[model samples]
Target: MKKILPAILLALLFILTASSVGYAADIQMKVDGVTILAEVKPEMKNNRMMVPLRVISENVGANVHWSGTEVALTKNDRKIVLTLNSDKAVFNGKTVLLDAKPYLKDNRLFVPLRFLAQSFGCTVNYSHTTVSVDTKPFYIDGVQVAAVQEEIQMTMGSIVDELQGHAYIETMYNLLMQNKGNEVEAPARISLNVHNRLPGDYDQVVQIDFVGENGDSITSFGLYAEVPSEGEDEGEPKVVIYAETEKRWYAFSSKASQEIWELNAIAGKNGFLTMISNTTP
Candidate 1:
């Protein structure tokens, strides 16, 4: 995975280093004289400029596959594959020898970006502040649909609401909005464990809320919890909620703290509640 510094820090670093480093002039080439737009990131080092090969390749509707030993570039109707450690490259059935070897610096693999871009009939352009690649748009999956591979474990529990079955887990309240704005409010239901830490009657209340990708409020629901024990002022155990929808948000809150903090905003909405032990004779 490419290590990403915070955007602000990365920008600042580039500015501080730019003056002492040589820069590349913007140059654009075309495949069959067709123009395409691309975003370029460049670096100046040792009185020379360097660009990422993968970035240039992929920007021009080409795919780059590297397995730590070999690299391959492929696109519809064309293919370029090569192996490293032996100074060999193959372009569309034409084998060629490299005058120099590709090496890694600061964990990034560096190669001749211009050569790769031109090999695919694409043009690369660079200004003092930007690099642009122009290539035929390639067909691939949109980034929004990719599945997230991060693993997060969630704890689940349930608390009975009322004696004699007077109360039960409520159905998720569906709150419809008329404006159809990005934000919506909806009810949430989750099973929770009910146990009082101290000997006494206690009650707990929980709430849920959803935050969308744009950092907008979507939906929120409040839950009421009842237990039998004394509540703890410090380190009181509480429940957190996790949503399991496609591209959903993972919501989190704590009744122990009596304040809600978002656990995972990238997932669907979620919430939590505080419970004090309730004692009943």
Candidate 2:
């Protein structure tokens, strides 16, 4: 793994340090060429760039968890632990001192940008007040991901929302990858988990397209609940995912199925389902 700071970035840091270390209104952050949609904007504090811990970490393919004043971040083989108001950080079990301490702002934990990013083997560059973070391109099933497209499985398929950020894209991808099911002779009765069923399964709630650089879908899949028959009680969970390209089916546990439903429901709430049909004409 590359060390946290390089000479050129150090020089850039010096230039940024000379500026007013307060509001980050002029500072823009981009990861892998996509502007980060951070709930709290990145700010400059104590000559170091402070960014929301979760927002920046997730963008670089790192998972974040907060336990009171302490937060843990992990990606691949690396793990980082930091505490609020402390300059000390544990990287891969080795302790190191940070140039600045992390602090809470508006209930969000903010950490030094370069330190947390480099810990995961990403490069950070500062130019014209925009911080560009470049991470090794993430691939799923050997295909480079460009973005994630969410679609409504209504009468016909209609795209409702899309997310270009690596953080969001990776999340939707994992929901499919992690819950793969055992191969079986294709089920006889496959139903779509939708509000109003399609001619067959039109309204299958979970419709995700992982797009590549050329704006073509690398893979697509849908999931539906396979609840037990009236008499049955114990067996596979309710979720059954079908990978359209591979023509494969997988059964996920009840817990996982519930989570999938919640995810699609959340996406639907943000999409045309909320405004186009629910309230408007």
lDDT of 1 by residue, 12-128 (tens): 888866744433434332222222232444554443345555444533445678776788888655677656544567888888775444556555565665566667766666554
Model 1 Cα shift for residue 63 (angstroms): 2.4
Model 2 TM-score, 2 decimals: 0.72
Cα error of candidate 1 at position 234, Å: 40
Model 2 alpha-carbon drift over 4 Å, by segment: 1-23, 190-203, 226-237, 257-281
Q: Candidates' lDDT values, in order?
A: 0.39, 0.69
lDDT of 1: 0.39
- Number of the top candidate by lDDT? 2
Q: What is the Å distance of residue 172 in model 2 from its true position?
A: 2.7
